[model samples]
Target chain A: MIVHSASIEAINKDIHPGMVVADATATLPALKVYNYKEGVCEKLLAELADWAFRFTPVIAVEAPDRLLMDISGCPHLWGGEEQYLADVVAKLKQRGYHANAAIADTIGAAWAAVCYGRPGQIIPPGGQQTALSSWPPAALRLSPLILDRMHRLGFYKIGSFINMPGTVLRRRFGQQLLTRIGQALGTMPEQLTSVLPAVIFQERLPCLEPIRTRTGIDIALKTLLEALSKRLLKESKGLRKAIFKGYRLDGNIQQIDIGTNRPVRNVAHLLQLFSQKIETIRPALGIELFILEAPVVEDLSAQQESLWTALGDSDANTELSNLLDRIAGKVGSAAIRRYLPAEHYWPERSMKISHSISEKPDTLWRVDRPRPICLLEQPEKIEVTVPVPDYPPMLFIYKGLIHKVKKQTGLNVLNANGGWISKRRSGITTALKTNRVRGIGYSGRVNMTKETLNGIYMDFLHDSYEAV
Target chain B: MGQATEIQENVVERLRQEILAMQGLRVPLENELRDTGLGIINNAFPNQTFPVAATHEFISDNAQNGAASSGFMAALLRILMCKGSCLWVSTRCRIFPPALKAFGISPDQMIFIDARTSKDALWIIEEGLKCQTLAAVVGEVQELGFTESRRLQLAVETSRVTGLIHRYGSLPTNVTCVSRWRITPVASIGEPTIPGVGFPGWNVELLKIRNGKPGRWQVAWNPDGFKVVQQPKVIEHLPARKTG
Candidate 1:
């Protein structure tokens, strides 16, 4: 293809001149020369489809960098037909590529003209050969092997190749050579398939006057949300998350992105979520135009009605979640936490913070086992003066106060695995051992057995404890 | 032995059934007491109607005995139970459970949370009022600022949950609360004609109510529980003789 050859020349400076480069051009026959087989013709076709919409919708990509446009009516707007072609070439050059443009009635004629015709030649409806007479045989985009064979057959150029016997050409270079010759002459009607354009969803809100204050920005955000919500509804879609871009006249842009727990179109709910997050958007020299674009959207499908669904009663879960959101917004989120049940029945380790979303599965609260309503933040170390082993201590010293045990209750059971380990006592076994060592006497070790952990009691001997 | 186990199981089953049967029996007793003005309507609110929107405050001195704190809660709860449920976020276990039950507040209707310190207690009470389900929220806390009290007042105005703040110990005089009620325990009477002998009696004084007259009233909280009675209008009274 001419694009391959043109791109090769364009990238020659960057490529080492003497390197033995494999001509991947054959592997991707229609790929641009500079692309070096990295991109397929299909992907290039899509890119061209998106880019060439500026010129005309009737454009279709011919193999390689070639584009065929039925610009039968839409050319004079960009100055004139010749100027428009020049404008397209200039734009392509600006996008880091050199391109050649030509216009013709049939796609084959246009392809041949751009690849082989003289510079700035507009081939008439029926003039294909006369238009391509002076072009080289390689301009037909035929295999180099076939072109070399044509040269050997005394056909140095396409004009001379056309005069050669058609049977001789097919017999020598196979049928593909004769087809390419016919295609260049506009006799074969070479098909140029078009690609569908990608769907793009975007909504823009231009502020009537430049918004600078917090109130002004909030008002503008409401307007942007309304426009975006309407567009999403019309498209039968809802956004999972949206990006609010504040484009300032000074060229700096600030983007504030907010995500919702569920698909939502309710303006008030969305406003409340964003009101907590809009502070993250640094106004940045004040915004003039606001654009809300949703990159993540899905079809709005109805949930299957369930026979067991509660219809009239209000959903308590939603009310709880909204209450949590409000509390988290006012007081820091760290201050609010919902109690979650743990597998083990230990009092201290039985609860953890639940996630903000309500969809997460939770463990059921168990009522049979008695859990202490008040858990001492730290299990204070007590010095037992009573005889150890099987008996509960009659008196123990805690915080320097000797409290006598009024009652001795024991819950005897085997120590289970995965029990609650309080954070303060990281090495619990060692801490328990240390308590035994520091206890009343050397005989205290006998009382520190795991079997004796059922219950220990103490009462205050005196009100002698002072603030530490 | 097997028959004894079966009998015990039957007894447990019968008790559960009895409890269920008695759930609706309180309506008549409450009505009769309401007619006599001796139930929660009389004991808690002598004003005849329930204290709905306005804030009721109790400021305690914690003097001679810790009566002001406990008595204020007992009286306040009695009034709150007249309307329905009352929420008590207890800082210290300063609330006497038996006293509140004597005032006709079923233990089930009153929810109690024993927090470690006074600060944690107010936080729970504040959070409870925001729920708007409680008829009255009572907290026995040491201190509450003007701004914090205003926040509670505002939440109560919107939710209609009566805010009853009972200060635990004595606070400085300048400290402002919505309304203040001081409670003190006097000697108990033996009988209708007899002098004084039995359990501790409570002297309920409405030191402050937003739109109502503040006055001291005599009430005997004997072993038979609290009973409102007429007493001579005097600032100080003679100590009743102890009867053996």
Candidate 2:
């Protein structure tokens, strides 16, 4: 591959950019090579702009390693403009970067001086013409084709065309060439778009010394929480999730996080949530700094504390979500569940466990059919004694207890007492209809067939009918 | 002597009233939340009304007893659930939500918290009991000690939410629950000479109650609520006297 960039050491060896890497390595067998990506230069320039924020609040990043800072009145903070420029360049060099900076009356002049004139040069107002005349025509930031055409026309440097009339130069080399010169000489104004960070919800507490005790950490967390909640309360917003981080003196970060089902800004409740997880953090050496970040926030319209605190049905729902949140934090969210009705015939599939506490059921729970309050997880097999043909069981054995069946459906028979005693088919049963129970018993042996018995037989959840 | 005996009776009556008051057993009004469909059984309570925000225990001998207690608890929870939800915390719950509809309680209004361990279930139950937002908390555990039951009582006292504990064993006399009950499924009798298992009926026995009398009642389930079934009037027929 061809060379993309060359260091000062490589340039001193006459290894200019655009030369093949094979030729350069042949010249110096000890040369090191690395691959270059497209956006590396822009990324580095943006980071440099961020670092330069200490110098000026208004800083803009230009592509391909350029930064524009509006230092009109900011230089006095650092002694003077020259020292400021030296300090900036020196700092960049100390970080292993070769940097050139210039201060001029206009942005275009400053850019041209940094690119073409001597390094660390400061130009007086209206002196860009004298300083830039000796540099090449390309220093005006013109296209390569325009520079090639100017070179072919015997114009090698800015001084060659410095005294030419603008109209004549525009006609010969096009308007772009004259426009660049005018912009550099301060004949035109320019706009600089500054980058400023947006406000974030974060609070920090830097301790005077390393804090090693649990009380110290607790105090730090409380202070940060108070500040954060105050700001959130003022903004009519609340935090749904938050993280607390401690910067330990041993260079380790101890972090704990908490989440809420609903938006909450109450410091007391949030502190209680953190208290459940506070013991998990080991403060080892000591904590030097603490930071709390609200990663998730939501809008909760403000209401008076007394109004919400008053007992009401709506407030009960709110308090319930908070209570569930606290319980979930202790035993995980999976341990808690709400149920909704599912339109299924099987009892197991008739209801489903719901994760959301406030979800509405699609199908109504069937009240027409009777269902058992406590269904056996597994079907239980018991012993039954059928007294006669086409008749309900007379006695059943469940859990080794002889529970004599009291109700008989059809074919009424007398017990030893002979009082027209019928083993009552479970009357008012959750599984049977009232009329069906009456019809089977009062109709007198007409519907006592095997098929009808199986219908009542299938309702195992109703009672100990499985024994029958 | 008669006058002295009258004075002693007056003092004893006053002492009883004082004890009832200290137990927080003031009689509730007729139109309040004390209507638990218990009929005459409600009078057996200390205040002649069903207690709310108090701990009740149900002891079961086996699976049949367990099911009966669950049904009875669900019936009570139905009355307590007034636009509020109930938490059924247990190791593994087998109650069918759709079946709760028969008790006049919509299944969607109930939350089931299944814990992997009985201890976790107890913790969840205590937490739910302490939350004033819930209507009631039903905990089905294998066992609970005297101190644990006392802790649960304290939680309900502050939150004013009822707590129901179900266990498959003998009752604990030293527990701090306000009342203890045992329910057994009784054979159902059809209405008006119709034969079959009519409404699901149970033999509800209040074994012990604080500052109240223990009694037994036969209750049957209806879509509306509990119906107290009267004892059957069985007239004895004279055995034939002509054996000689």
Candidate 3:
């Protein structure tokens, strides 16, 4: 096994990584070693990142051993950059880790200062060039092959070619060397993705007095909503769902939430929606805190309101949403339904209920087929008496009234692959047309005096083509 | 003697205008008049025009009537929606949304709000009426007192939205509405041997109306439009087809 990593004492003995374990053992017979486990470096870096959150909200973890933090506005809290850098490195060392930190304007410059320059160095802003000039070409974060080539060319230090003409350096060392120098010198932009996944839109309001009355609760809710909506509007986002919670003095938490059919940021409309549920929130014994959180937000394009459609249409659209929001606030939002056509033969599955106003049907509603105006939630079992086979029931009784089968229609059974086919799949057609049709899906359109029952299904237990 | 009769007729016309104005009804000019496509039924409404901005109550006393009233109102809403959105509020929405397509109204445009109680349904309906954006609001309620309906009427006055209250299985209350109607199921006329449920027909009865005739008519509704099943008094009601 090779030495993956070695302590400073082993390094002093010239035992470096990639050296055979036996050679390292010979150099120091008392050398210690441990088995290498996968992903240990990454786990340690993540824990360090979690600790780094106390310093700055904007921080990223570059895998293996680098913690990049933008401390442009963060160091002042610890008095100055020197103390901040010292405290950071000192605190990490106190955690039984040998940590070095460097503060600079650019990520590359700071990385170079931390890795190659003196420990706990603080390079002045915009002075990355002078600070990095003393370091070696390895400080520029170049590949090992390029560093070896530079070493062979007798350009060990970066200052050896600091003032070299751009074309000359480009021809000799290639474009990668120039790009690394450019990145360190802040000539090109680099991105730092934050540790936090997404921004949380939340607002808190602590009441000066414990609000006991409904009016007081309403005021608190409105105040929090206004502040939250302002932040949402500035970001060009709207919340589809939001929660309002009140922390009571008695340690009881009362919470109410509102959901919009679509994303909304309008304060007045949101207030109106919340007003409907204010009565349900019992501020029992008084409440001390109120919080509004919007967990589900979506980009509400501001241009879409003005760029397309006529002026009256967009206005009416918002007004309609506002109106629906109020209704949803009063009744549960589930009660509100809008249906789109679905391409299915079973009546219950024929339509899809949509919640949003902007949803459009993918399939056109079939007008050729007749549907009932009022559909029964469940089909009532009717008593039918048949005298012979292959004929419709002679008479049927429903709801205490007997319906005489003067004119009878054919029975239709729908298969998923095949469209409506005849009832030839039923072996008992001679005995009873609806012998075992109970609780199965079949389309049997009944023509009665006033109402029609449609979308009935019949499956045969004894026939070979049961599905058909 | 002829001058005296003209003076009396002018006085009657002035009084009619005053009453309509007090009720917050807008008098449409000749070009602004909208045809409800109800054929002669408009003859039974004030100013010979179906009040699109007013509340119309439909009383259904039986199961069939409940279904028929919804079907009949769906036809009216199709014409009155003016390509705008609609709201249907109820305790439990029984009107099959797909069935609205049969009446030429797209089901997607109709939002059904299910309330836990009839009181809540009416409240939602009143709030819906106050919004000027909606073209129509249909509330399925079992009962509504006179005071509650007046609030609904007041809501529509500020916003020119048509409100249809389909109250099922309840005694009719004295509501200060523009009109009251009872739509009963009429056995659909079809070929007996064809074995089909046939076309939907309603025996539409105008039980009450102010400043107009109260009449009943048999009307059959289809996607194309309404066909007056039995045209009433062709010779006597000739003026209605023109004025309405």
Give a tens-digit lDDT track for model 2, residues A1-468: 999888889898888889999999999787889899989998888888888888988888888778998888987888999899999899989889988999998887899889887889999878999988888898888889899998998888899897899999888889888888888888876767887743478999999988888888888989999999999988888898889999998899999999887778888888888888988888898889999999999887687333467777657877887788787778777777778887654455667888777788988887654445655555554444555533455554444655455544333332222234334543323113221222222211111101111112224222223212
The digit string of per-residue lDDT tens for model 1 on A276-378 reads 7788777766788888877787775433111113432123333333444443444334443334445554333444445444323256444332112122223
Measured by lDDT, the strongest candidate is: 3
Instruction: Estimate the Cα RMSD of every predicted model relative to the unseen true structure.
Output: 21.8, 21.3, 17.0
- In candidate 1, stretches whose alpha carbon ends up further than 4 angstroms from where it belongs are A1-203, A206-209, A231-245, A249-264, A276-284, A291-312, A315-320, A332-334, A356-364, A368-370, A412-468, B1-42, B45-143, B162-244
What does candidate 1's lDDT look like per residue over B94-178, in tens digits? 3323234444454444545555566666666666666544557777677777666766666665666667776746573422343
lDDT of 3 by residue, A262-344 (tens): 78877777887887778888887899999999999999877743433346677788878877877777776778888998987
DockQ of each: 0.04, 0.32, 0.37
- Which residue runs does candidate 3 get wrong by more than 4 Å? A1-196, A212-216, A284-286, A304-311, A385-394, A405-411, A415-422, A427-431, A434-439, A442-468, B1-11, B29-32, B190-197, B233-244
- List the global CA lDDT of all models: 0.54, 0.73, 0.76
TM-scores for all candidates: the values are 0.42, 0.58, 0.67
Return whichever of 1 and 2 wins on TM-score. Answer: 2
CAPRI docking class of candidate 2: acceptable
The lDDT, on a scale of 0 to 1, for candidate 3 is 0.76
